[model samples]
Target: MSRKSETSGDRRPAQADALTLTGRQAARVAKRRRVMMLGLRGIPNVQGGVEKHVEMLSSRLTGHGWEVEVVGRRRYLPVSGPHLWNGVRVSPLWAPRMMALEAIIHTFLGICFAAMRRPDVLHIHAVGPALLVPLARLMRLNVVVTHHGYDYDRQKWGAFAKKMLRTGERMGMRLAHGRIAISREIAETMGERYRVPVAFVPNGVAVSHCDVETGVLGEFGLTRRRYILLAARLVPEKRQIDLIKAYAKLGNTGFNLVLAGGAEFESAYEDEVRALASRVPGVVLTGFQTGDRLAELFANAALFVLPSSHEGMPIALLEAMAHGLPVLASDIVANRQLDLPAGDYFPLGDIDALASAISEKTATSLDEQEVLAQTERVESAYSWSSVALKTLDVYRAVTK
Candidate 1:
């Protein structure tokens, strides 16, 4: 008897079969893929750019079906033990509270934990934590280092610390399986310096939906559209002092100058900022705001200013634009990468220039069209979802 002829029902199309196989392969990779992130303070209400970056990136990575665990410093994390945060696991590890010793010690401990857990990829954030890249490599772990910025350029670190950071940059750039930089300038600099291909995955901002709540306004003695806001950690490189001096130069402009962040560790610099703010009229220091409070500050501000001398792509600047607030940042390489109009930037560390810009910006408000355009621009360009996808590509590349 002749065998039944194969029909469409018996054999699938070649393209269809390939598509099915690809889908299965993707599912298998997602199921088995795991990444452990370290080198940030923690997530969920943590301050600092790196912390916020890790928080947003790790949460979105879970949506791609990759298992994500962030190793957090126990001193900074609000909760104890391992817990799930936004579909990503947070493993709190202990570290000394000292500013200089905390990151390295915490990273060393995290590396040991990573060794035991043996995540498919050990993703380390920032140069300070990147110091342990060699140790992570020694354990035969697949390490991916993200250069947030040149930490050695910051004014806070001492000579030895700066040397260590430089060494970390060297080792992380040369030794890691994959390298990522948060800004084009950083990626280009590291790539040219090390002669390695570095991925440029920028920091992102989430557009806030929170209403302009007046509770936080009243609490901080701020009025809607009547205050200039600077929200960043109390650090030397952030140049809060420059902004404060500039705001002081504005005299009585009928606008309050609000500093909306606090330091991770108590330092003389924090004390100095507080003292300076105390001396200036119409200047308010709101210590370390998160959640709706920060959103309100952004939503209601007349203008936002970032006078930082160093950054890896400032997330606060993006958040300010996302809130449709007119922004004035220092003309630094990192801030310039955002491609804001030349008029929006002032000479770095120039108090007179910053004061003039802030005066001009706050005197007039952004029209409805201007506000919408700014918000749309930020949302389109710097999206956390987009960052997650790009970062996933890097992880996959290194894994392969």
Candidate 2:
């Protein structure tokens, strides 16, 4: 007896069914693969510390098999380009240019997009955008927030804005599925106040050994090791004007005073800083140098000074340490976390003390051993690879 031959028609249906099932599984995997980032102006050479942090973290996450997408402000990012860069995708959404409205508006739009798209994770950076954490939860989205600093403490914000920031901080810490604080101080502050468990993930830096490019020095009329560098945005809290006044009081020590950042919505403050800096001979205002120029400034400066009255974790200070420059910073809790030598810190808001520290530190060069120690500490404590790994662990914990 001959058995009925199996027909191609029956085989074709089974094969098609198997292919369809496989396609659905693959699509599900892809859908589960993405992490959506928000609350930065943009990445890939954007200005703010939050932008830089996201740029490094998001790019590194992609190498670990994450499809990272950052929601950026349209005005900050270029209008025309492929959305994907390297492995991270950038979605530039529109927002007004006004400083007060920019972050909130952009973040609202970003959160809505993440909700509609249904990304596996929605990661928001900084307390300003964390205001929407409750809303994100209501949308049934998994949320993670990184508190860069207490923005309410910043001098630029008005009373209402400051109150809103405080509310955001409270809600974000209480509501997010996972939370990251950038410094020990921040972690402690949040834990003590909000009673929430938070992870401490400090910022990272790229350690390099390039020689100080003399061309940049010449352009700014700076001599190697003859300048004191203060690189931060011109804002009242940063105390750039304090640095200028201190330098002016010191009366033209052969060393130049270099201020290496542009204005950040503080036109009046910027104008005051400029006028003060202009009055002092050898005070160079090199508005916002990045890449090689910034590196050169760090490498060649006699000393790096950050007199900020408030901070989360100062990336400027870390960059200086990476460059192996001697550093003097204000005695704030955030700066204190650096574990710097006691001699390296001046009383906060003390112009005379800052001037004295600058004079003493600049006159006395850092010992070779001290410089090596600083570089070693930076390498051990703040490498991007290590930071990325820790952050990924947080992501995995929340996702699971």
Candidate 3:
């Protein structure tokens, strides 16, 4: 499909022209697997990257004839009724010790549910797999786990909590029938830290399919804006405050800087960003923009920046590239693993370098590195379709 002329400057959907077979005609198509997706969150609405990745993957794999189901905590996804989404079964966790047990009970319920479901393949999305490892083996379930990159590294965990998470994560990775990590960094980390072999499968984005509306920006008097955007959560690891400082250093040069993530669930960190955001001029903190609002924030921005100390192939970065917007990011190992366009990079904590990168982006358009390179390195390597396929391969290996 040829792209029509850009009327409003919004990037349109890329070609999704594929002939697909329906479930009614499932026997006719090549797809032949029943997969149960397990995690703490379910579909239709989810907060994190793992949930979004699984949501999109479930839709794509289902259209291709793979049976899919997602089971998550009832508190996260309401337990009122059983639901179906994009050909995936949605079941709720209902255990007595749930609220008191800090996710232990949720894992217990997940194990019981998985054993009864008897799925041909079970794809676990996080460290929850360790809790279910024994049950899955007992039930003869094919288990595959995907490492979501350093969940244990967050500041929310104290010494004991960190130690527990580390041990559990190691156990989960080791006991899985198969494991997949999103970036070379994660793959290497898992192997080096835990001595576990993990297939590298990075996340992807549908760059062109994004729909952004800056109408909300008008509410903040930032309509038709050309500001830099920082879309990550307000956590220390994400380095959001550093971006705020960079914006402060750049300081209101006809461009408005906007941040559209939530107040941290960790109140102390949230307070730090809030205090930092207050001090930065020409900077608007639109706390926690969701679906359409997030797209709008990305759409109207001149550049997208991720000043994270660490990352595992950020989806927002890919989304920015797909939207054809220039990127300015911290040069972390994970960020370097995926080949992007001629993006500006800054030293991790250097405010001067970050300001320079943002100013350079504001000054001119970034060059597009060769098309074949992007197609091979960006498009082929880290797409939802590719992730779905690699995930299916994991399923096959576990089952066999």
Candidate 4:
């Protein structure tokens, strides 16, 4: 099919013609380019990576003339009903609070809502939710599915859940009208495995001026630039235990280790993380921070470490680099794709190597020139504006 024919009903007119249209006419055009996004917990200070991605991408799509609505689980959302945030409409839908069933149930309900509303496109994020793509297609709704990561590879799921996640990946990649992968590695793997084209639309980072406030530092009893920061949920794949053990290996480093996230659901893993963290001195657990507190944590850390065994273009790592902090990450495919310096990556799940890297990184302060260069590199490559435009192209491709 020709591109113009596929996008005839949804694409905006040429710039010259758009400039000549009346305000009401422009509103009508924007309404025609509607997209409903699902597959995340909630937004507007939600802690998970997918939630942050949807919040950033959906909010920015409004600027480019796409009417955006993010459907999230009612249990996780801060508000009770439909609301407007940053010019995008957010609808909180009903979903059971069970850990295993919440995503698929919420997505099924969101797809049904989309079918009735008949938006120009229904954009689903993550493979777990993408399991319902076939259903959306059965309802004759234009569908776009974004494979955030290989959820089957995450250590949190059981064998049966892992198998189901693999099936979700298969159905989402093969059945959706449009496919997007957040990492180049994921896109390539899906294309090769499913024999389908997948757009590589990476997660983005917004670099903001550093917040010099010390109130949060005081609250946490931390010193500026004297704490090693890891800002991810207390999940098994994130390998918080590895970081804690590595920090214990470094005796008298004078740097506190701060874990700035908590789990959304109750799990034995979270309990284990807390027990292990309490045994080690100089380890602080600040549960699920956001807004200024998270910014403060990012801005004042001595070094940022992401020892995750699984990821889909980690937004926390990107945000840390955007803050000009030196980073150490696991050498997984997703983290390696960031192309950080060779010394910045240690082998995945190697506690000794992670310890050595953390010690070496904290021994010296980052040079002013090096900080500026790192900040510029991340800011240029991972701007949210670029992400929004690329995603809009995907929506246009599948619409009409």
The number of the candidate with the highest TM-score is 4
Query: Tens digit of lDDT per residue, candidate 2, span 152-208?
Result: 999988999999999889888999999999998898889999898999999998854
Which pairs clash in model 3?
261-288
lDDT of 1 by residue, 1-400 (tens): 1244333355566534544567777567546689999998899888888989988998899888889999999978889899998899999999998989999999999999999999999999998888889999999999999999999999999999999999999999999999999999899999999999999999999966676564889987777899999999899999899999999998898999999998878899999999998999998998899998888888888999999999888999999999888999999999999999998999999999999999889778889999999898899999999999999999999988
Report RMSD for candidate 4.
Answer: 6.0
The order of the candidates by TM-score, greatest first, is 4, 1, 2, 3
Which portions of model 1 miss their true places by more than 4 Å?
Answer: 1-30, 212-214
* Candidate 3 CA-lDDT value: 0.72
The estimated TM-scores of all candidates read 0.92, 0.91, 0.83, 0.92
> Which is the better candidate, 2 or 4, if ranked by lDDT?
4
Question: Backbone clashes in each candidate structure, one number apiece?
Answer: 0, 0, 1, 0
Overall lDDT per candidate, in order of appearance: 0.90, 0.86, 0.72, 0.90
Q: After superposition, how far is residue 125 of candidate 2 from its true place, in Å?
A: 0.6
Check candidate 4 and list the clashing pairs: none
Q: Write the per-residue lDDT of candidate 3 for residues 1-400, one digit (tens) a residue.
A: 2345433345443211112445455445433678888765667556567777788788888876788888766655645467887678787766443322536566667767878878888877766445556667777778887887776676556777667667667767878889888887888878897787899887877644345454777877685547778776676778888888888887668888877777324568788888877877778888766667677777677888888886656887777766667788788776776554445677889998888888888898645553234434555556789888887787778777
Model 2 TM-score is 0.91
Better of 2 and 3 by TM-score: 2
Q: How close to the true structure is residue 117 of candidate 4, measured as C-alpha lDDT?
A: 88
